[model samples]
Target: MTGGERRPVASRLAIRFAIILALALLPAGVIAFIKTDALESEVEARNEAALMGATVQAAMAETGLIRRVRGMVASLSHLTPTVINDPAACSELMRGVAEEEPTASLVAFVPVSGVMTCSSAGRTYAFSGNPLFEKVVRLREPGFVVNPRGPVSGTSVLGISHPVLGAAGDFMGYVVVSLSHNALNELRLDTFDSTHGSTAAPVEFWTFDRDGTLLTSNLDLAAAAKRVPASRPLAEFVGTGSTVVQDTSRDGQKMSYAIVPIVPGDLYLMSAFRRELTDVGGGLSAYMPTLLMWLIGLVAAGLAAEFLVTRHVRTLNRAIVSFARGDRRLQAIDLDNAPVELQELASAYTAMTESITRSEAELEDSVHQKEVLLREVHHRVKNNLQLISSIMNIQLRSAESAEAKTLLRNLQERIMSLATVHRGLYQTSGLADVRARELIPDILRQITSISSGPEKPFVTETDIDDLRLVPDQAIPLSLLLAEALTNAMKHAGATRDRPGKLRVRLKRSGGSEAILQVSNSRPDVSMRARIPASSTGIGTQLIMAFVQQLGGRTDSGEDDAEYHMRVTFPVSPLVTAENRERNEASSDKLGNDPV
Candidate 1:
């Protein structure tokens, strides 16, 4: 497998075990989550109850204060007209009523003309445009109204009015009691302190009139207003019974509000408590125990796999890797203490390695025998060719005519060239191909020895690159080189005036081709001119035949002061036994085909 595709055995086993563990514990996790949700609901319910209780307690305190105010107003309504028409006596009576109720800011009697005639502050006031007077006059009923600034008290107040009637039951005027907003807020705080104590969560309370006019709050009026939900106005909760609702406040804090009526349609106490219970973040904590257990189980599984299985598998892997790296010496895998399956696998691997080693040894021996036989055949052939050359040399020495002697010597040189090829084959380690670097120099030495003499010595230069050729091409190439060298040496004769020079080069031309060049210095141009221009001679014909056998082309010409011969050919690929067998099979099939 590629490196990216491979994973550690321990990690893979750990992941699988983790999946199994999760499935096994799925029900328990679900149960814990359900329990957590139920617990959250219980907390929210309890908080709601506490909030409502606190609101109702504060509302009761407010209701008691309003009732006291009404009682005081009722007592004043029975006042004798003799004292009521006297402004000083009426003011004295109202001041005594205010003293009796510490929270009352004003006790006033306004006549039917909507003007206050008697007051606790002993001030006359016009109430014609006052909403409290207008409502009391029109409805002629007991009612409540909130004024930011009362004309009599000169402070924020809640006006509680009770309509009065004459002896004839005709509308006379109204007795209105104004309670200070700050005093009412202090009364509510006293109730909250007694009921909740210091340990209770902070709560804000706002009292609203039936007309939605904010009268008093335990906190700052503006801040307490922000505690109320923007979607629900205070008037919406005025006539409703005690209720609890969950909503976000204007300041974006989640809150639970308890709306409890002090007087069903006149006043409401709205207590806003921050939703600490419902806001509990329990999602992760609910699953933490299960997740922690899963992690522990996964780690244990990974360790177990590493210790019990992967360690043994890694040992086996090391042995296999060593064998593949060509270490023939067999190394034993110690897996006896491993699991039964792993032991059996190791046994099978050992047996397979043993078989492979034996096969390799036998194959090596067979290859050695084949190489020896091939060398013997080439050696015998070379000996026979040398014997034939020896015979031709003796014939040349005893020839009767000059032409016959020249023909015999040329034939001897050709036979000796074949011997040189066989000698290179037998001496080389590889029997299938010849090394041009070693063989070409040997062949050139043999040709020079036979053709050159001490009196007519020619300087020869050779540049050859190491190349390999099969026997099919090597034999013809050797003969071609021999003929070309012999012809060049004959024409390039050394004299006292100028020495003859012969240059030969063989090298790779491009990617898959080779070039062979042989050039000689032309000291006497007249002598080369005397030679026949037509290439119909034995040497020329033999060179052409060798070039054709090698599947190449040749070029020959005189350039400047030298005669040059160049041969270019494609290098044939080395053929292995498999390729040779395939080629033979194809040839047989083609031969059997109908023309």
Candidate 2:
């Protein structure tokens, strides 16, 4: 697998998990918060309504008690002056009213003489028994009192008083009726309990006087009343509307207090509310569904991610392996559905593979063309050398003198030596170097066979190997060797009876020079210039030219009946002039039109 394909699953999973978590948490948390907020708002609305109803019921009940007591007082005030002057008749009237109206705790009638009398519980009481009656008798008009007592028994009640007068419109006395506070308290408590029982949260009922004095609450009334400051800010809201809400506390636990304004704003303020119902965020039940949704969504997204990652990696791996196996023609992997990084990886892989394919094709074509050109060059050189050898052979057959015939034979051998070099080049892929040891002996043998007459027994011999020459230097050196060997064979000859040996040894004296020495047992140095001065043999002149061209020195020596012709040439050419000439000749042969 390639580097991209080898990406670890742990990293990929971590990235995917992070994305899914973000997606799940951001929306789910927001929705849950909104839902919680909505629930709190709804609960607050319900609490407000409940509080308003409780406050209204308490106010109605309290006001009705005052009104009922006042009505009773008005009825008694009309019969008061007649009944009051006669206490017995007044007691009868008061007792009859009290028994009929069970809500009235007591009844009283006071005379203009400032004496009060009361009837309750089947007994009558005199006004002198209670000091509160004295204060009421001094009143000029009708009035109501809170938490009053009966005229004689001192029974606590909510009381009201009205004036009673004679037919002459003179003030005679007053009448009083008391309503029971305990019955009103019981009714208020029952209504609050009923309203509170129908709700999921706690509900409170608070009643305060106009000065914000706490009167009633679902909590410990006396304790709550003490905690409520006698002078509170609710006095400023005496005339406000019903159902005012604010987050507050009764005894330090958090609560929402809703203040409901009662009717007759001058009397008192009644409030009802709940506590410990604020939205604290995520209800446990709500999280069950939210978590389930998040988990489901995360799983689906993870599966999709795995599929995409696997597909992209597999495609990249296939393409990479194909390229490794020398198949550069693979198509690019398409990772559009995959991640952006994998897409880039695929594109880079395709570009690199395409580049390699083009380079390989170009290299292969270049090598093929080089091989073809090399083979063509060697073939042409072989043909040209053969042409030169054939031309020399034609020249030798038309020669007249024995000297010319010998020279012609030597020229043919020189051309043949150059042909042998071409043969080596044409036969092998490497055209530049020819093995000279094998090549020289083969050339000398050809020369001996061509020049030998029927009676002559000439043999070419040499102990030579491990020698190499480049074609450029070998051609000229071959010509020089051919000339020396041919001279020994033809001019320094032994007859059949003599059976003389001509020894030819080609050896390297040092690392730098090739030494060709041809020695014959028979000594005939005078025979070397047998090609006369008057005659211009082509081979003789060419031999001298080739020797000079090779930059070599030649010497003819004799010792002990052996004639030695030693020619020493540098291992390589002194200059590239010969190479240049060869190039020009090759070019001329290639571009020249055949004649």
- Against the unseen true structure, what C-alpha lDDT does each candidate score? 0.78, 0.62
Over 4 Å off in model 1, which ranges? 2-101, 104-118, 124-200, 204-217, 221-281, 289-308, 365-595
- For model 1, residues 368-387, the per-residue Cα lDDT tens digits are 66668878988999999999
Q: Report how far residue 48 has shifted in candidate 2, in Å.
A: 3.4
Which predicted model would earn the best lDDT? 1
Please give each candidate's TM-score: 0.60, 0.38
- Highest TM-score: which candidate? 1
Residue pairs with clashing backbones, model 2: 116-127
Candidate 2: Cα lDDT at 278: 32
Q: Which ranges of candidate 2 are over 4 A from the true structure?
A: 1-47, 54-66, 110-115, 119-144, 148-156, 163-174, 188-234, 247-250, 253-263, 266-271, 276-595
- Cα RMSD, model 2: 22.4
Error of 2 at 514 (Å): 62
